[model samples]
Target: MSKAEKTKQFIIEKTASLFNTKGYLSTTLSDIAQATHLTKGSIYGNFANKDELAIEVYKYNSGLLSKSMSRSFGDEFPTTMDKLHAFVDFYRKNWRSVFSNGGCPLMNAATESDDIFPGLKNQVKKSFEDWAGKISSVIIQGQKNGDLNEKANAEEYASIFIMLLEGGILLSKTTGDEKFLNLALERITKMIDNELNILPS
Candidate 1:
């Protein structure tokens, strides 16, 4: 890559966590400069303005989460049930190392940018739609393979799963207790095993 491209990526990488943690409006160019060790002029040279920079940083943070979930779903799990379980496992295992850095970038962006940043709010919405689509597709596949109950509504189940998981994360972070998250995951597990999974006749 060219120097300009590399420099822009460096700024994005450096400021992604800052934006996620401190938020879009709360985070200023000065904070980014401090985090990236770049001059204000350099930051402005790479980005048009704070809004533009925040948009890119939000994308970067969201991509990190998407990539992690994709890797866990694709690499470590074989069956559909296993893949679903992997979602819970991914957050459980990486809450400290990965999630706590920013605490679910999509959720953070959605909550922080909803009223202020229209562009970011829309992106967050798209992220949720995309995630729900993925989960629904998996459920459809599982039903076709006779691994999951054919009667289960993929979209409905996907929506509930996302809500429960994200709510758990929020509660866990707010209360400084991992048990809330674990409880949600445990409930999801039971739903998967008892409600979604096909049982012998």
Candidate 2:
């Protein structure tokens, strides 16, 4: 890789957590400079402005999260039900790591960018759409395999699942109680077993 590209990536990696924790508006170029050990001129040399840098940082943070999840839901989880369970397990097991890293990047960006940064907000919206698409795809596969009920609405279930999980994250983070997330996971498990799981004839 080119030196310039490496430098840019270094800046993104350094500032990603800062942006996730302090947020876009609150995180300044000075803070980024301090975090990256780069001069303001260097930062600007890579990014056109703070807005551009923030957008890239959001992508970097989100990409890391997606990669972690993908790693958790590996090829060993062949069945859709297995994959879904793994998804829950991933969050449950990694909650502490996530909390220490400043919470879910997608959630942080969505909540912080809305009504403020239109570009960033739209990016968050696209991120949600992409996430829902993945979940819905899994639901459709489950139905095809008779692992999940054909009567279930894939999109609707996906939306509910995301809402419950994200809401649980928010509540758990706010209250410093993992029980809130566990409760949400319990509900999801019931939903999968009772609502989506296909019954034997």
Candidate 3:
């Protein structure tokens, strides 16, 4: 890659944790520079502005999540139930880190950007749609394989799964009870498994 591209990625890598932990609105260019041992000018030299950097960081974090999940659900699973379990397991592994960082990026973006940054909000919406598409595709694959019940709609299941997980995280964060989120995850995981078993077997 080019020097500019490398610098941009460096900024994103250094600041992704900051953005996830402190929040996009709360993070500053100086914070990223300090974290990366670069100057403010160096950061801006790569990013036109902090807003641009924040958007890039959001995308970067989401892409990392997708990669982890895709790896977790690889071809060896060969079934929809396996993929669904992989999804739940990934969250179980990451939810604490995500919550400590002020909860999930999508959840934070949904709450934070709604009133302040329309552009960021739009990006969050697109991100959700993109993630939902991946989830729906997996569910459809499972359905085709007769692993998931045809009566269950892929998009609906995907949306509800996300809602339950993110909403649970939000509440868990608010209440300061990590168990709240884990219990929610466990419950829904059980439900999803039960539903998965009911497929036309």
Candidate 4:
């Protein structure tokens, strides 16, 4: 990476949490300068403006989450059921760590960007679509392999899972409790076992 690229990434890393916790509209160039210990000139040199920097920061934060989820289910799970279970398990164990870092970046950005930040709304939408695509791919592959019920709609299941998980995160974060997320995971697991998984015939 060039010096400019490194500097841009450094700024993104430093202010990612700030953007997630405080928000895009609320955060300012001065706040970023304070976080990165760089002058506004330096920041502007690296990024066109605060809006560009915020979008990059959102990508950086959300990429970490995407990679984390990928790692959780990557190679360890051989079967579709196992992969789905691992998906739920990842949140069950890592929700606190995720929350400590300012909750889910996708959720934070979605709520903050919608109808407010036009520049970021499209990016957030792409992130969500990509997430759903990953889960739907798993289910689609399972159906093709006869590991899951063919009747199950992969796209619908993917959407439902995301909704439940995000809703759970919102509720859990709001109430300062884990039960809401746990309950959501419980439902996901049950849905996988009862509704999606294929029985020996």
The C-alpha stretches of model 1 lying farther than 4 A from their native spots are: none
Candidate 2 TM-score versus the reference:
0.96
Q: What value does the lDDT take at residue 8 in candidate 1?
A: 92
Clashing pairs in 3: none
TM-score of 4: 0.97
| Every candidate's lDDT | 0.87, 0.89, 0.80, 0.92
Clash pairs, candidate 4, are none
Runs of candidate 4 with Cα error greater than 4 angstroms are none
Taking every candidate in turn, the Cα RMSD to the unseen true structure, in Å, is 1.2, 1.1, 2.0, 1.0
lDDT of 4 by residue, 1-201 (tens): 998788888999999999998888899889999999999999999898999999999999999999989775577799888899998899998998989888999999899889889889999999999999999999999999999999999999999999999999999999999999999999999899999998777
Q: What is residue 135's positional error in candidate 3, in angstroms? A: 1.7
Each prediction's number of clashing residue pairs: 0, 0, 0, 0
Candidate 2, residues 1-201, lDDT tens digits: the string is: 899999999999998889998988799999999999889999999999999999999989888888888664577998888998888888889999898888989999999989889989998998889888888888898899878999999999989989999999999999999998899999998898889988677
Model 2 error, position 193 (Å)? 1.1
Q: Judge candidate 1 at residue 65 and give its lDDT.
A: 84
Give lDDT tens digits, candidate 3, residues 1-201. 998898888879978888887888888767888889998888888878989888888888877766776765688776778778888888788876776666788878778778697878888999899878888888888778777777878898788878888878888888988777787778768767876456343
Clashing pairs in 2: none
Which candidate model has the greater TM-score, 2 or 3?
A: 2
